[model samples]
Target: MNTLLLHCRPGFEGEVCAEISEQAALIGVAGYAKGKPASAYAEFVCTEPGGGERLMRELRFERLIFPRQWARGEFVALPESDRIGVLLQHLAELPVFGSLWLEVFDTNDGKELSNFCKKFEGPLRKALTKAGRLVEDAGKPRLLLTFRSGREVFVGMAETGNQALWPMGIPRLKFPREAPSRSTLKLEEAWHQFIPREQWETRLSGDMTGVDLGASPGGWTYQLVRRGMLVTAVDNGPMAESLMDTGLVTHLMVDGFVWKPRQPVDWMVCDIVEKPARNAALLDDWIGGGHCREAVVNLKLPMKQRYAEVKRLLQRLEDGFAERRIKVSIACKQLYHDREEVTCHLRRLDR
Candidate 1:
C-alpha cells in the first residue's frame, strides 16, 4: 500500500507527474510516477514501504500546481464475487477513517463509472460501519476509495485540512445567467481558489473601487458589480448593457496594455489574451507603480512546457517585486474553468 494516487485535469498528467517526481526527490523520497497523458490521473509508487506516508507528511498539497487531489494508499483488484468481503478485508489492514468518499477519475470513461460508484457507496459505507472502519472524528484521516472500474479500486487516505476543499478539487460553483458570459466562472473560481472566503467581507466590498482590463461583454465586471464595487472597465470592445445599467461601471474605450488608472484602485483584473511573460510584466508594473492594491491576471500558456513556463514567470514576478522593494503576495493556479492558461492572484501587503 505504498502507492499515491493523484487526480488531475485531463491532458496534464505529465505535468503532474513531473511535479510530484521533483517534489518526491526534494523531500528525500525516491519514487516513480506512472500514468498516461489525458488519462486524468497519476500514481506515484514509492521505493519503500510506508514511503507514501513520509511523502504526504513532507509535502503540502497547496504547493502542488497540477494535482487537484492526492491520496496515499494501496491499489487493489477486487474479486468478481463477494466484492464487499474483499474490500473489507483489505480495508481492515488500515486505520479507521473519519469519512469515506467514493470517486472516479476526471475523464469521460471515469464519468461512465459514476452510477456504479453511487450505487456501491451505500452498501460499502454500511459494511465499513459494521466493521468498525469508519467513524465521525474529524481528527482521523479521510478514506478515499477511487474506482477505476467495477473490478478495480484504490484505497487511499488524506488528512482533513491537507486536501482540496471538494472532491477532485473541483468546486461546485453555479453560473448565474445575469453575467454576460460564461467566462465569469473563471474569475469566480479564481477568487474561491486564491482568496479565503472569510476575508471577502474586508477585502472585497462595495466600497472598494477596481478596474477590469479587457472587460468586453462584462463577465468579470459582473462579479465586481455584484459585490457592490465601482469598476472602471477598460476595453475597446462593447460591454454588456445589463452591467452598465448597474451604474457601477465606467467604460473606457481604450487598450488595456496602454491604459492606466487615474488613481490607485483597490483591484485590477485582466483577462487579455497575451503571452504569459508580457502579462507577468504588466502585473509587475501595476504592483510596482502602486496602480492597484491587488490583481487577478490570466496568462495564456504556450502549448509545450506549460508548467516550466509558469515556474519561470512566477520566479520573475518574485524578482520583480524584490527589485522594487515591494512587499507582495502572489498565488497562481490552473483553474478548473481555465484552459490553455493559468490565473494569477497578486496583492500588495505593504505600502
Candidate 2:
C-alpha cells in the first residue's frame, strides 16, 4: 500500500519515471520508479512505510512536468468472482471520500476499459453509499481508482484542493473548424489552463489589442481576433486571407525575434520554433521591457532532459522578473495539441 500511481502521456513513461525518482530523492524520500515505455502510467514504490504520502505532500502538482495526474495508494488484486465485494471491503477500510473517479491510462488499451468503468460506477457508488463510505461534502478527499485491467486496480486518494480538475487530468476541448490552422487549439487550451474563465470578459475584451509574432497562417492569431480584439499579425510569411478580411488584423512582414511593437499592446503571443532557453529569454525581455501586458510563448524541446529544461527556464524567468521588480504571472504546460513543445503564458500585472 505504498505505491504511487501516475498518469502521463503515452511514450513519456521514461520521463515520468525519471522525474518522480529525482523529485522523491530531492525530498529525502527514497523511492524507485518503474514503468514500460508507452504504458501511459508509472508507479513509485517507497522504501519507507509512510513515504508514499510524504512524497505526495512534498511534490507540488504544478511543478511536475511529465505527469498529468498522480495519486498515492496501494495495488489491489481482485478475485475473478465477488469483485464488488472485494472493492467494497477495501473502501470500508479507507476513509470516506467526497468523490470517486474510476479511470484507466490514456492509451488504446486503457480506452478499451472505459465502458467498463462507466458501467461499474453506478453499482460501485450504490455499494459505497449503502456502506456509508461515500460522502458528498467537498471538504473530503477524492478517491481515484485506476484500473490497468479487470483483475488489477490501484486505489489512491488526493486532496480535493490539490488534485487535478478533471479525471486523468485531461480537459474536454473541441476544436473550431473555422480556425485557419490546428495550432489554434494550443492557444485555446492555454487560456483555459492559465486564465480563469470568470475573468475572460473583463480581461479579454474587444477594446484590447494584441500582437501575434510568427503569425503565419494565423493559428494563435485567430484566438485573439475571435475574442473581438484588434490584432497585429507579425510574420514574414503571408497570413490567411480570411483572417485579414475580419478588418481587425494588421499583418506585418518581419523577423519575429527582432521586431518590436510600435506601442505597448494589451497582449503579445509567439509560436516560433526555436530553443527553449531563447524563448524564455524572449519572454523575459517582452514583459521586462513592458512591450505587452501579457504574452504566450512556445518552447520546442530537445531529445532529452525535457523536464530539467522546463525547470531551468521557469527559474530563469522568475529570477529575471525579480531582478526587474516586475509583478507577473507565468504558467507553462504541454497541451493536448502540443507535441515535443510546451506553451508558456506570461501576464504582467504592473501598469
Candidate 3:
C-alpha cells in the first residue's frame, strides 16, 4: 500500500511514532514514524503482518494509525466505535479490510457523513458514526466493513451487496481492522494526541525514588525500572512477576490514595480507574509534599467532553503544582492502546 492511516487524538501527532517505537516490539510493521502530536497526527508505514496495531498488546498508547502515505487508493471509509472487539474478527478474514491506509474521524454533526447514516440503525449506526469521524472527510466511503457480525451479518450492506464495484481506473481500498484505551483507550488521529515515551526515560539521580500507583500487572512499573530507579508499586491487585523480580520494583500492596513514599521519591506513575479530578488532586498532593521529582500517569475519561476535561485537569494540576514551585511538563495523549482516557506525562518544572 502506498498510503497509510494514523490513529491518534484530534491534534497531537507531532511526537507519537517515536514514543510508539520506544516500546514497539520489532516483529510487526516496518515504516517511517513521522508526523506531529500537537495536531493529533501520527503516520507509520509498515509492510508487516499486523500493521503494528498489535503493539497495543504490550504498550499503553492512544491511537490506531495507518499512514495516508501508504495508501494505494484515493478514498477510504471511516467508522465510529468505542471498542475494537467487535471489529477484529472480520478484519482478520477479509482482504479489503485487513490493513488500512490513513484513518480519520467525524462527530455526529459531521458534514461529509450526512448521507451515509441513512442506511444504518442501532449498533450499526453507531459504528458508522465513529467511522465517519475518523475518515478524512465525512462521505460515503470506498471501504468495506470487516467487523464481527451480530444481528447484522451482511457485508457491503452499506452499498448494494457483497461487493462494491468502483471505476476500475480508481485505486480505492478498505481499511482492514477496527479496535481502545481511554483501558480500551480512545484516540482520534485528527487531534494528534498520542502517548509519549521520552518522559518515561527521564530518571532522577542521587538516591531519588518513586511509586507506581494502580500499578497492576506492570505497565508503568516497566518504565520506571528501565530508568534505573527504585519503585514501590502500590496497588491491591497482583503485579507482574517480572517487575517484582527486578529488585527495583517493590509491591506495596496499598491504596495509592492513602499511601506515601517513606520519604521523597523521584516520580509517581498511576494508571488508576478513578475520576479525573480525584487523580489530579492526588498528583497535587504528591507535588505539594515534594514526594517525587516527576510523574507519568493515566486518567480514565467519562463519555462527555473528554477533550475539555483534559484542559480542565491540566489547568488545575499546573496551578496546584505551581504554588510549591514544582514546575511540570504535562502531556495528555489519545494513545492507540488507550480506551477512552488520556495518558498524562508530568515532570517537575524545576527539572
Candidate 4:
C-alpha cells in the first residue's frame, strides 16, 4: 500500500490534511493529502514506494493532533459476489494480523453500514483464521478494513501499541446520570486520552485537591468530586445543589479569569468559554506560578485557520515556560466529546 488512511471527525477533513502534510514533510516524506469536506476521513498518497509505511513507523501517533486512527494501505475494489473470498485472496499477500477492525466513515451514511460490518466480521474472521492469516498475538499488525462503500474498501495495517485503543480513535464513554451536564464527558474522555491509566491512583487520588474554573453547574467539578478529591469551584453562576451537597466542594462566586487559589493545588481544570489564547494564557500563569501541579483546560478555537491557531498557542506556551525556566509537559487533543475546542493537559515536570 502506498497511502496512509487517516480517520478524523467529520467537517475537519481540511485540518487533517494540513496536519498530515506538515507532519510528513517534517520527516522528509513527500506526499499529498486528499480529503472531502465532511467526509470524516483523508488519505495521504506517498511519492515513493513504501513511503507510507515509513511514515507510519517514524511518526509518533501520539504527537499527531488531528487524525484519530491511521493505517498504511491501499484501496481494494470488492465485488458483491463472494466478498469474503476476495478479501482472503488479498490477505494471502500480507503478513498475519493480530486482529481485525471493520470501520466506516463517521457520518450518517457510515452508520448505515454498521450492521453490515458487524455481520461481515464473523465470516471474515473464520476465513482468515482458517488461512492462518489472523492470529492472537498482540505484537502483530492489526488489519484495518475501512469500508467506503459496499463495493469499495481500503485494506490497511496499523502497528500494535502505535494506534488508538478504540476503532476510529474514539472511546465509548457513557454519560453519568448524576452529572449536571453532558459536558462532564469531555473531562472524563480527556483523562482517558491524556493520562495513562496506571498513574490514575497517584495522580487522581482522593487526597488530591483541585480547582475547577468556570465550574458553574458543576460539570467538570463533578468528575473531581466523584474521584473523591476536595475541590474549590469558581464561577459567577451557582453550582448544582447535588454537587454542593457532597460537601467535598466549596463554591466561590468569582470570575475564573481573575480567580487564583491561595495555595498550590494538585489539579486545576477549566472549561471556560473564551478565546483560545486567553485560555492558554490562564493555564500558563497557573502552571508557571505553581498554583497547580497539573491542569486540564479546553481551548475554544476560531472558525478559520484552526490548526494554525492551535500551533501558535502551543508554541506560545512553550516559549513562555522556557523564558521562566519552568519545566512542564503539555499534551493536547480534540477529544470525541469536544466540539470546536480542544482539551489540553499540562503537568509540571519539575515537581
Candidate 5:
C-alpha cells in the first residue's frame, strides 16, 4: 500500500490536498495528492514503496488542520459474490488489527451505503476473527475499510492513538432540546475535541467564570450554564428566558468587538461573525493581556485560499504571543458542527 487515505469534510478536498502535500514535503517525502471537489476524501500517492508509512510515522496527525482521519494503504476491488472472502485473503498478508472501522464518505450517496456497510461489518468481523487477523488490543493498528462503492474500497491501517476517536472523523452529538439554538452544539463539540475528559473536573469545573462574546439567544452561553459556571454574556440582544432562569448567566447588551471585561475571566468564548483576522486579533488581545486564561473562538474563513489564510492567522497568533512573552497552548480544528469556519482553543500556561 503506497497511498495515504484521508477523510475530510465535503468540498474541502483541495484544502486537504494542499495541507498533506505541504506536510509531506516538509518531512522530505515525495508524494502527490489526488482530490475531487465535494468528494469528502482525498488520497496521497507516495513515490517510494514505503513513503506512505514514513509520512504516517513522521507526521503528527493532530498538527494537520485539514484531514480528520488518515490511513496508509491501497485500494482494492472486491467481488460482489464473496466480498468477505476477498477481504480475508488480503488480511492474510497484514498484521492483526485491534479494531475495524467500515466507513463511507459524508455525502448523500455515502449515507445510502450505511446499511450495506452495517450488514457487511458483521460477516467481515466474523471472518477476520476466525482467521486470527482481528484482536482486542488497543495498541495494535486499526483496520480501516473505506468503501467508495459496493465493489470499490480502500483498505488501510491507522495506529490507534494517531487517528480520530470516531469513524469518518465525525462525532455524533445530539442537539440538546433546551439550547436556544442549534449553534450550541459547536461549543459542546469543541469541549469534546479539545479538552481531555479526565481533566474536565479541574480545568472546566463549575467554579470557573466565563465570558461569551456575541451571546444572543445564548446558544454558546447555554453550554456554560449547564456546566454550572457563572457567565457574563456580552451582546446587545436579549438572551433566552430559559437561560436567564438558570440565574448563572448575566446578559449584557454591548458590541462584542468593543466590550472588554472589567476583570480577568477564567474562560472566554466567541462565535461572532467576523473576518478571520479580526477574530484572531480579538483572541490575541484577550490572551496576551491576561484578560482570559483560556478562550474558545471561531475564525470565519475566506472564500478562496482558505488553508493559506488559516495558516497565516495561526502563525500571526503564535508570533504575537511570543513577542509579548506570553506562554499559551494553542490548538485549532474544523469541528463537525462548523461551517465555513474553524474553532480555536487558546490556554495561557502558568508563567
Candidate 6:
C-alpha cells in the first residue's frame, strides 16, 4: 500500500509525467496511479513497493513525495499504512528543507487542486503540529506560476516555510501539445519568454543576422529563421529540409566555431556538441572581436560537474567581456523539456 507522489513542469505535466511513467516502469516500479487534474497530488501505489531508494535511482524528478500521496512530486515510495495526519507531520520536513510550492490548477478547470487544498487543510496544518515550519511573523507569501500544455496553475509557498496549500482544483489534463520540435530541448523557443521577443527585436538595430552552430536538423535555427532573421548554419551535415526551405538560413559546410563570419552579424546562436570553454571562447571571439552584437547559445552539460562547468563558462564569458567593458545579461533555467541540463540566455549589451 505504499504511495508515490509526482510533480512536473505545469503545462508539460502530462507529458512529463507520462514520460516518467515510461521511465519508472523501465526501472521496475509499476501501477502508477493516473493524475486527477482536480487533486494537488498524483498517486502511485506500488503493490510491491520498490522503496524510496529505488525511485531516486530511477526517476530524476525535482522532488519525491510520500506517505499520504499528498506528494507534491518525485515518485517516492510510501507505505500504505501511513495516515493522512501523520503524512502532514512527515510533510513538515518539506517546508523546512525542501523548496515547497502551493500548486493551484483552478484557472483552467482547476477545481480539483483547490478542493484537495481545502479538504486537507485541517490535517495538513495539524500535521505541522507546532514544529512551526511557517513564519507567522513574516510578510506576504511567495508564489510563482506553473503550466502544462496550455493549462496554468499558480504556485505559492510560505516564505521561511516549505509547504503551502494549493489554491485550486485538479488541473484538467486538457490542453493539446504544441507542434513538436525535433529534440525535446526547446531552448531557443523557451528563451523567447525569459526575455521578451521585443527586447531582441527592438534592440536589434537592423534586421540582424546570426550563425546557428550544429545547425543540422535545425531546431535552434528554426526559431531564428521564424523570427525573420537570416542564419549561417555551420555544420558538415545537411540542414533539415524544412529549415533550409525557410530561405532565412544558409548552410555553411564548416566547423561552427572555427569558421569566422565574413562580416559581423547581429547574433550568434549555437547548440553545438562541444566542451563549455570551447563554446565560451567561440562566443568570446565573436562578441569580443565585435563580430556579433548579441548571442543565444546552449552549453551542453556532461554527466559530471555540470553546474560547476556552467559556472566556469559563465565566469569566463563575464571576465572576457568585462575586460573590454562590455555589458551583458545572462539567464539560465531548467526548461520544461530539458533533461539533466539547463538552457542559458546571454545578451551582449549594445554599448
Off by over 4 Å in 2: none
**Which digits, one per residue and each the tens of the lDDT, describe model 5 over residues 1-351?**
789999899988999999999999998999899999999999999998899899999987777787888999999999988988898898888899999999999899899998899999988898898889999889999999999999988999999888886898899989999999999999998998889889888888899899999999899999998889999999888899999999899998888888888889899999989999999999998988889999999998866899999999999999998988889999988888888888999999963
- Lowest summed lDDT across 10 adjacent residues in model 1 is found at 59-68
| lDDT of candidate 3 over 1-351, digit per residue (tens) | 222333344443433455445435354445566654343334455456554434433333222222111122112233455333344333334333321221223222222332433333345434433654223332322333321122221132111111112211112322222211112121112112322334323343425577878877666566556557787888888877767777887897877899887778777777788998888888777766778766666677774655556667887887876666766666565444455566666656664
Off by over 4 Å in 1: none
What's the TM for model 5?
A: 0.98
lDDT of 6 at 305: 50
Scored by lDDT, the top model is 4
State model 5's lDDT. 0.91
For residue 32, model 6's alpha carbon misses the true position, in angstroms, by 33
Error of 2 at 13 (Å): 2.1
Q: Which of candidates 1 and 4 is the stronger one according to lDDT?
A: 4
What TM-score does candidate 2 get on C-alpha atoms?
0.92
Candidate 2 displacement at residue 301 in angstroms: 1.2
Please write out the lDDT profile of model 1 over residues 1-351, one tens digit for every residue: 689898988988888888889889988887899889888899899998788999889888877878888899877899988889999999888999999888889988889998988898999899999999998888999999888888999989999878877887888899998999999999999888888899999889889999999999999999999999999999999999999998999999988988898789999999999889989988998988999999999999866898888889998999988987899998887777888788899999996
Per-model CA lDDT versus the true structure: 0.89, 0.86, 0.48, 0.91, 0.91, 0.52
Give the CA lDDT, 0 to 100, for residue 295 in model 2.
90
Model 2 worst lDDT run, 10 consecutive residues: 58-67
Candidate 2, 118-150: lDDT as tens digits: 988899888888888887978998889999998
Residue-level lDDT tens digits of model 4 in 224-277 = 999999999999998999999999999999888998988899999999999998
> Per-residue alpha-carbon lDDT of model 6 for 135-166, expressed as tens digits?
34335333222222122222223232222222
State the lDDT at 318 in candidate 5.
98
